[model samples]
Target: MRIIILFLFFIAVGVGAFSQTPKKKVGADNRAVPTKNKIQSQMNEATSGIAKEIADLEEQLKTETDEETIKNLKEQIGMLKKQLKMMQGLNKNVSNMSNKVIQQAFNSETSEIPKRDVNRINSLPKKILNDGELFVFMKQTTQEVENKLAIEGKKLGMQLFDTLKARKYSAQAMGQYAFACMAGGFPEMGLYIYGKACLADMNNADNLNNYAAYLTMAGGEQYSIPILDNLNSKYPFNSTILNNLGQAWFGLGDMNKAKKNLEDAVRIYSIHSRANETLCLIQQSEGQTQQATES
Candidate 1:
């Protein structure tokens, strides 16, 4: 329910920045090796700094009197705590692994679409609905699909998936089918399809964004962050990417980053409803009543 689904139909030009290859250093034997200990030390320092900041913020909270200041202090403390927790988790989980191994582990966890789901989706009978028609159907009936029309929506989603598969699963076709599956309430299927769509069209911004959004919605904030960060670097000032980054940060309980990105998104595009709504929610939570109302 907290998912921020920002499905865009328009295609943008760019290479998919899904995974970044870690820079390697050549050893005496001319073999590339990852600097695992260096990275771990850096992480340790970051976590320690964040822990200190949280302690400072908590101490500030104890003496804060003004309602707004108090709220801001609490949010900062909460965000710092969450960030510290995440850093600690990373350190605990991957501290001993080489950078190459860590990257491989991350990619394996995030990128693989389930083979069984893909086969089942491909096995459904192909429907005659074109992309435009499918989009229209999903747009008009998403709410209904969530309620009384659930059965019909699921069937339609399956058919759409099969249709795309039969068409050789072009990036555009795969994206549309993924959207249909999402709108039709088949989230697991949709997520897998989104992964495939992203792989099929690594350069397609919409496909990557949708995949990242689904990951965040499914509680994979750590995984989504890298994808969103890559997109943000490639497409600076993009409202959709910024909004998604905000959502992912929020999911990780990094209120400060969430607010900053959501605010940036709203500033870049005033009419971005999702960005505006999320920014307003953050403001409201922080007791910025006037700002929330204005937003």
Candidate 2:
């Protein structure tokens, strides 16, 4: 009788311990529910229609081999990268990655990242897009379909202009609008828009760089030279700005300054192809034909 009573007591103790474990589990479960739901919601938002399409395009970039198609795809990818960066509450600084690095990151043979990391991409509250956001979206859509799908890029540009008339243009929006204008084959209008953008955000390094580049491309370096000089004074180490300054000086018939800036650009970013090309052209012009060819 004593042995049986001891066994019964032990059994009751074990049952009590087991029963108490449920309360602990229930508390933990309740705590986890909110977290679990939050994560799922984030995943859903990150994989929403537009975000998912961007991911799919990124994946397609991995296998794409045609040069023209690759160029177009990279442009799309760049915009998507910016969108992702904006959504993550990070600074929307334009990316200046080399094509090699970009290709490596999204390359089929070497991709290590998921299609899109929901944890990284999700968190933004939905609201009406500001001018900058809407402009960038329209620009990306214009580029994606403008030439490839029988859609006119110029028409998109007109639509962008109409939209901009109703709202004050942000610096970024103006810059993007200029690009859209260029794409639409309105060079003079593009230059005008770029000029406005630069005036609106003269202190922005990006705006300065972009504006100078556009001026150099248009052979209006007389205007670009001062802007580039100002930018160089501020960001001496920026290779793109340096290259553009070189191009501007070259357009202005100032070979010495052009050579100096181009050389400096190459020194900073050894693989700066445009700088190398300009340097080679300068060498050829100066009768250093051997050096030009070798470079």
Candidate 3:
């Protein structure tokens, strides 16, 4: 019956809502049981109940044109589709948050990520889709490479290098490749990837920033000095690039200029960790450690 189907739908939704924690968060509760997974199991049960009811309605209704039966079936199908979409979205969020946690862990410990999450990330298909979804997936996968993930990230990127060999390139995809290259500690490769994207779209700031970022990261202050100067010339008041420039100046022992660039950078991006840290260092150098402490 239509009324019975509706009741089952509400029950499934209720279960999904309660079992909202990600699969990776198991053993996170005081009860030593993951509440979310329990709820997910319940949802699976309720989904089975809906399937049974739908099957019963289909068998009992003789004609496809029976308006009530047709309408009920359509509603059931729609509900299933919506739930699938919700699940996929939840999967993406979970993957992203897990990647962040892993990055922080690496920063503190300087070690490899667990093989499980690494294998899970690597399992994403190498083939990029046309719907612009592939970029997000690739980006998520690349995040596994904290400073410690350099080698694994290289392997993952190289796995798909063959896929693009004969394929027509897009700036969007190449930009993502640039990201992977940078994270993997291949600045030359990173610049090469960004260069391909820039060749496709010369004025793309995303590509330009990556180019600048790798230059700074690779050669320390020497190469970064000229690059940052040029970048600041264009985006004079841009905090992100300026912050980078300050660090370069510091590396070159240009204390006065480092202090200036860092001051402007922190002014523009008040809460930026790198900029604030660099600025604090410069202040300490200036015999103003007290001022840096206040900051």
Q: Evaluated with lDDT, which candidate comes out highest?
A: 1
Candidate ranking under lDDT, highest first, comes to 1, 2, 3
TM-scores, one per candidate: 0.46, 0.46, 0.44
What's the C-alpha lDDT at position 98 in model 1?
Answer: 60
lDDT of 3 by residue, 155-248 (tens): 4334333333334546655665454333323344444445446445544544544444444444334433444454455556565556666755
Q: Where is model 2 poorest over a 10-residue stretch in terms of lDDT? A: 25-34
Where does model 1 exceed 4 Å of error?
1-167
Q: Evaluate all candidate structures by whole-model CA lDDT and list the values in order.
A: 0.53, 0.48, 0.44
RMSD of candidates 1 onward, in order: 23.1, 26.4, 19.2
Task: Tell me the deviation in Å of residue 210 in model 1.
Answer: 0.9
How much lDDT does candidate 3 score? 0.44
Error of 1 at 28 (Å): 55
Query: Comparing candidate 1 with candidate 3, which one achieves the higher TM-score?
Result: 1
Q: Give the TM-score comparing model 3 with the true structure, all chains together.
A: 0.44
Model 1 TM: 0.46
**Model 1 error, position 72 (Å):** 58
